[model samples]
Target: MNLELVTVLVLALIFVLATARSVNLGVLALVAAFGVGAAAGLSTDEVFAGFPVDLFVALTGLTFLFGFAQRNGTIDLLLRAGLRLVRGRVALAPWIFFALTGALMSVGAIFAIAVVAPLAVPFARRYRIDQLMMGMMVVHGGMAGAFSPLSVYGLFVNSFLAGDDLGGSRLGLFLASFVFNTAIALVVFLTMGGRFLLGRTEDLAGAPASEAEAPGQTSGQASAQTSAQTSAQTSGIDLYQGVTLLGLAVMAVGTAAFGLDIGVLSLSAAAVLALMRPDDARVCLANVSWSTVVLVGGVLTYIAVLEAAGTVEWASGGIAALGVPLVAALLLCYLAGIVSALASSIGTIGVALAIAAPMLESGELGAVGFVAALSISATVVDVSPFSTNGALVLANVDAEHRDDFYRRMLVYAGLVVGLAPLAAWTFSLLPV
Candidate 1:
């Protein structure tokens, strides 16, 4: 068999092994990268060069920065503030969490899920809200803002399009995702019994305020400080947490307004926080999702080899020969949505864009709209049980009926995978 065919077959095998054996797909992909790189007649150095250094820096920096926030009780502070903003309106509780998480993702996608899912799931359980509703809303909110101009997804799409000399609208993609996710959230709110929460605010605050302390901390300190902190929180934000919130604001505005390098600014802000709270260093560092970092590094490294070997071009060429741009677009959308529902949404988006670029350049379809359809469809299905955001929710639930929640999420996510691509495509067909 030819080199291209061999590498493609290996790709299929990696997915099968990961699914069947519950192994880290990244590890398998890294091994395949070496074998495929060698089979393609590339030198060792060239293979290593395919490593995605920039993405590594981006994911690590954001996770590291947010890790500090998580440990320092800053995220807890935000949750308290959001709950207060809802003012006992349980019906609005999920929306509050949704908007806040969406705003975070507008700044950065990967870090948003890591930070928000932990908080939202617990909140859902506390109020007897549907875990699937709350969890999936958080996922949708993350994807909603994920395509904003300052976000990684938007940056990736824009850069990819620019490289192809295509004129794509950054705002268009953002709007498409925002609208699509909002519609989904609305449906969830109405059908999932959100209306039942109205005027029913008792017992919501009956649960004692719980603190999100760094690992290795004591309940003694938390108990002693809980009343005072709760009182202070009622009137105003805690001093240290307020400062951390300010720092987060700067991270957002600095990157979005001033066009600062997000990775650099995140690391700098986290470093400052770290210096101020040296005792929290170990816990913060421990919380950064190293597995995700490794997954991204490995998967993209393998993808780089595919790019180097002209496999992406070969795929696009075949898609182009189909003679129907819309049909090709739909197929690619379904492919991206299906794979992303199971694996890395970011990876799937990158690969999908590579395949769609040829059809996009043919001018038979609207470049901006098609890109929006591709990206939103690729990410919105992160509600699937197999995806990180979905799994995060399932993990955070109280152990009671955990499997039942998982099954519910599975059913909901399956529905999204089946229907979301069509909605995303319809939204993209609009002029916006």
Candidate 2:
């Protein structure tokens, strides 16, 4: 009932509303953080502390590193190999891209939008598939990694849990859900139909027709096509670059061997890579998303206000009081998933865990129940209108196909809503 707590609660609601309506998540997060901090009588310095400096530094390094890799043919090598491997297997491109992206996402601890965007077009062209589908594939694949323990949000959640056994609590359940989610993504891609892409062959074959035309007859079209093709060719990676291999190895070793935090370690690896080729530093820097960094930083600092005001504690109590046990418990978790979808997963999971941790300690819910619920609820947020993944996928699609893209998103969303919760319920019954 405290005024500060009330202010935090209201701010949280407003943040979710803005995000749900497709407002810039980072901007909305910053506004909520600052607004709540001011209302709750927090100092400006304290309010700004939530800015994730470590995350920013690391991401900055990663941006530069990725840039170098692109410049030096590291990423290009990988792309070439990937494309070759995907040859004549266009329908499976999305799934393969998703898996690879998921792996990288875990290491980088941020969405690979920059990396995915430029490359998706080539893969689309090669497979004679729609650009929209290619975009969705990369977006969807990259997001799967976001929920992994190596992800920034995952680390944030684990940090909040403190002594609680997060890895032990839900590792199996999370893995299971990942499998099911992958299956669902595959199903969606298959439903799009492989035959729809055959028409691309005629367009691709038309390249010869242009050569037969006079230099002036098809000059503009040829020039544009050449540029697009060159861009795509540059994006291809060798797949055997020593730097690229070393970088991946270092990321994995740093996380598992040294127990170094991914956010820090990821950027460190990227920095090292950038330093190895200072000539391309600017490209690497350009690749980094300063906007995302600033956004994440602002929100983190702003949420610190709620922590100070004890708003999280109050909200947790309200959620627990909803009364669900046995069969109804599944419904409760599903509803929580929807709420999480409306908010960013990070916000919902953070506040919910702060509340739920104590409940688990009190024996109201088992470790398995908590883990299942959290994982399911968190994953569901990926499909929400406020979802970073959803936004990125939609943004990258060709303007002409946005409606079709959105329609597919809705279908994907329905699948997530149903399957995520079912997996949660099934996991709840397991012995984890």
| Per-residue C-alpha lDDT of model 1 across residues 1-432, encoded as one tens digit per residue | 767777778887887787678677778888888889888888889888877676567666677777766666666566666767666778887887788788877865457876777767766765678877888788888888988876767766676677668888888889888998999999998888888888877433423224432223355764465656666446656665666777678878987789787778777777787888877866777877676667666776787788778887788888888987778888888998998888777667766887676667767778888898998888988888788777877777767758898888888988999998987786546553
Model 1 CA lDDT for position 112: 80
Best candidate, lDDT-wise?
Answer: 1
Q: For residue 159, give model 1's deviation from the true position in Å.
A: 4.2
lDDT of all predictions, in order shown?
Answer: 0.75, 0.58
Candidate closest to the true structure, highest TM-score:
1
Q: Model 1 compared with the native: what TM-score? A: 0.87
RMSD of each: 4.0, 5.8
Query: Which lDDT tens digits does candidate 2 get at residues 1-432?
Result: 676567656656666666657555567667777767787777778877767666666556555555556566655455445545645444555555666666666655365654665556444544446655565556556655654555554455555554355334324443654665566556556666544543232322223211222223355765567566665454434433576668767766877678776556656766666666665666667766676565556555655666677765565566667765335446556766776665666655554565565456555566555555666556644754346666655665555566776887777676677667766666555544
Clashing pairs in 1: none
